[model samples]
Target: MHSTVILIEFGAIILGLGLLGRFAGRLGLSPIPLYLLAGLAFGEGGLLPLGASEEFVAIGAEIGVILLLLMLGLEYTAADLVGNLKAQYPAGLVDMALNALPGAAMALLLGWGPVAAVVLAGVTWISSSGVIAKVLADLGRLGNRETPVILSILVMEDLAMAVYLPILTALLAGTGWVAGGLTLAVALSVAGLVLFAAVRYGRVISRFVSSDDPEKLLLVVLGLTLLVAGIAQQLQVSAAVGAFLVGIALSGEVAEGAHTLLSPLRDLFAAVFFVFFGLHTDPASIPPVLLPALALAVLTAGTKVATGYWAARRARVSARGRWRAGGALVARGEFSIVIAGLAVTAGIEPALGPLATAYVLILVIAGPLTARWTEPLARRLAERRRARTPGDPAHGRPAAEEATEPAPVPD
Candidate 1:
């Protein structure tokens, strides 16, 4: 009877998710927010709290996060990551400075102390790669010229996480300086070794993983990724990073086949992951933090736009593409929660989780809308400004060459 009850609960959850997904599709919106809402509805303080399947959902959510990172890694090779890191390290720095500072400043103003400030700084620094990737794919902008600039920034951020997560873990643990340093050293060494292997032996690894049987191929790749992710977590490095590195190490037919087999699994687990985030956030806790969360969200959104514009302009992408790039980078998701979750577990600040939850909720919904509309809105504003200015008296052309260029061709 207990087993049957668990199955029934799990089955109902899946069915509900499927319906919600279809509804979102019909409305031409991403289903993430809706999925999160469903989780909230079934969580504590909701109309019908979950019981039998809650533990199982938690496990699924962890897999969801790992799979999300792995699939993201499969999209690029070690060579791509290396080139992006070398070329776009400056943007990453700029991103950290502009976006991270606001969160830290807010925490200090609220008298949350230095630890909360550091935690919040990380919360604000990283954008949601998963959400942004989905938006790009939905809008067919993956081939856009500016996408490389956007992608490079994301790669730089992911690489930054390898260094950042270890340090954060040490700080949260309140380890001594020597212990922290040692932890950071181990994380760096592991990351460096993985990158080297991916770059030097990617082809060989892919060839070995490739097989004629799709079933065998899927199991091998899944098993290997899970094993590596578990080991990475055990080392306090980050399972997501380990999964991503595994993806980066494979190329050619193996990568393609793995991606094909795992895409569905990634989607399923990713949805579960988002839902799990919402499940932990009590609705009552969000009200007090909502005001601050809104303030921070508005402030960081603008800074993110500026970062994107500067990066795209440096890349020589068009004005529209620059806006698109900025808009694309506005959302914060899994990583932000992961950071806050650490603090919550440590009992650093009672309000931090609620703030982070509210912040992510607002942006995840607005992100896709911004990605879809920021360019058009920017263009309209630019045209209004140009119209207000007198055209060149001596030449038939507009005062700015950018004024007359065609819309950026979609990729």
Candidate 2:
């Protein structure tokens, strides 16, 4: 009877998600918000809470996260990561300052303490790669000139997580300085070793993993990723980071094959992951935090746009491209939840999870809209401003043109 109930509940959840996804598709919107809403509806204090399928959803959620990072890692080679890191280090620093400071400041103002502040800072710092990737692909902006700039910032953030997660873990654990330092050392060493191996032996590793048979290839890649992710989590490193490293270690045909084969699985689990997040948060808890979350979301959205515009301008991208870049980075998703989840599990602040949930829901929904509209809106605004400006006789151009003339800035 218990098994039957679990099956029925799980099946209903999946069917509901499929319907929501289809509805979102027909309306030309992202299905993320719908999935999250569905989770809330079926979570605690909701219309129909689930008891039997919660454990299954939790496991699927973990795989969703792992696959998300792995697919992201496959998008770039180690050399590309190194190059972007070197060229875009300053932008990464700027991104951190602009986006992270606000979240930390808000936490302090709310008296959540330095620990919760740090965790909250992480919640706001990183953008949603999964959502952004989908938006870019949907809009066909992958080949846009500003895309590399946007991608560089994401790569830097992902690499930063290798250092940040371990440190956050140690701090949350209240470890002594020596113990924390040891944890940091181990994480850095593991990351460095993985990167070095990827740089030197990527092709060889791919060759070994490559299979002509699709079934065999899928099994090998999935099994290896899970094994590495598990080991990394056991070592106090992030499972996402481990999966990312495995992705980094495979290149060429193998990476392409893995991406193709695993995409459907990634999509399925990723949806479950978002729903899992909602399942944990009580719908009743969100209203209290809604005002603050809305304020923070609005503030951070502008900051993210500014961050993207500045980075893109520094790269000498055009005005429209810069706006596009900024808009693309507006969404916050899986990683924020992962960071806040750790703190929540540690019993940090009771309200932090609710706040993060509301914050992410606002941004993730707005993210796609911003990406689709920022460029067109900026262009229209620019055109109006140009029409209002008097032509300069000396330069034979309007003031707006003078202001936006692209300068050649070296990457």
Candidate with the greatest lDDT versus the true structure = 2
- lDDT tens digits, residue span 1-411, model 1: 978888998888888888998998998777887887887788877667888888898899889988988998999988888888888889999999999999999999999998899999999999988889888888888888789999998888887889988888888899999999999998888888888999999998898889989999999999999998898888878888899999999988889999999999998888887777777777788899999999999999999999999999898887778898999999888788778877887888988988998898888888888888888888777666766666734233432456324554453
Model 2: which ten-residue window has the lowest total lDDT?
402-411
Compared with the true structure, all predictions reach lDDT values of: 0.86, 0.89
lDDT of 2: 0.89
- Predicted candidate 2: what Cα RMSD to the true structure? 3.4
Off by over 4 Å in 1: 391-411
